[model samples]
Target: MTKTKAAFNGKRLFIRLYCPREFKPKCVTSSVPVTRKVSNRASKRIKRLAKPMARPIRVTVRSGKWKKVSYLIKPGFRNKVSKMAGKRKRLLVVRDRIKAKKFAGRKFKGKSRTVFHKHRVVSGKAR
Candidate 1:
């Protein structure tokens, strides 16, 4: 007679069907719902917040020369920073970490070496 066997291979389900002697076995496999692709909405939001302000913000280095650093503002507040600039329309700077902690908790998260502590708007004429 014919017989069927089912087995699970990792995240896939496999089935085998065969007849006793004359017929060749057939195998079928399908992906199982054990795993799923997850989208990180938080990271996406943070990236969107940072993208418009592409140019690095200027900061004073140890030697007294100005250094350019790119940073991401905390999500859900890009518009607020834009609004702060008002008619002046200045570039945005992610505030230094030391000063930012007073405004929000866990304000920044990333594997990048640069860290953002807060957010500020500066006039184009300043730098």
Candidate 2:
């Protein structure tokens, strides 16, 4: 007969599938997927911002036990990754600035001064 079991840890959920008399049939675990939700406008803005970094540059590196091997990455891949990182950072700053503007003059629960200062600097309103 077929048997299935499920378990939930504090952080993740695991499911096991197997047949009777099987010591270790098959196990599957759930992990947080890497994803993000952004508005259409934001997506467009990101595309525009990242256009210049679409291509990546490849670099050679030594590896292996002997440490005398070299690997070549596709051209423009590294640049694209770096550009994406920068774009993400910029988007986060923009989001934070918007939140700060909306909550201006209101006291936040945690440290507000640092947030305000960052928002000021990002928005170019710093004196």
Candidate 3:
């Protein structure tokens, strides 16, 4: 279950290169003098972006991850999240957080994986 979500909403690579010309690498990445530097630059830029976005995606009502996004957080969703949340006050709604925390040593342990961590599960003080 956890593994599936990890792969589903996986991260994406977005890059706008500084390749000043159009006669780019004919086939692929190469040692050609002209394109090598450009390609390397692009690669470096990608690496930089990856590092920042690579942070674990945690789910918390307080967190802004799901800010503008809308999902039908109705009774069914509440029930599912409650059943999952159980006693723990954390949940990994996005998926990667589960992998990052390695399920928090319980193979189910996660950080801020609290389904309703902010509403009623943990306490009225969660807000």
State each model's CA lDDT, in order: 0.26, 0.21, 0.22
Best by TM-score: 1
TM-score of each: 0.24, 0.15, 0.19
lDDT of candidate 3 over 1-127, digit per residue (tens): 1211111111221111111122121111111001011212356665343222123222222211222121223332344433433354443232121112232233323222211111212211111
* Candidate 1, 65-120: lDDT as tens digits: 22333234334444444454434443233312111111123332321122322223
Stretches of candidate 1 exceeding 4 Å from the true structure: 1-60, 88-127
Q: What digit string (tens of lDDT, one per residue) describes model 2 on residues 1-127?
A: 0011122222222221111111112111111111132333466766344222112212221111111111122344333222323222421111111111112334433321111101110111111
Ranking of models by lDDT: 1, 3, 2
| Every candidate's CA RMSD | 28.7, 23.2, 21.3
Deviation of model 3 at 28, angstroms: 32
**TM-score computed on alpha carbons, candidate 2:** 0.15
lDDT of 2 at 6: 20
The C-alpha stretches of model 2 lying farther than 4 A from their native spots are 1-77, 81-102, 111-127
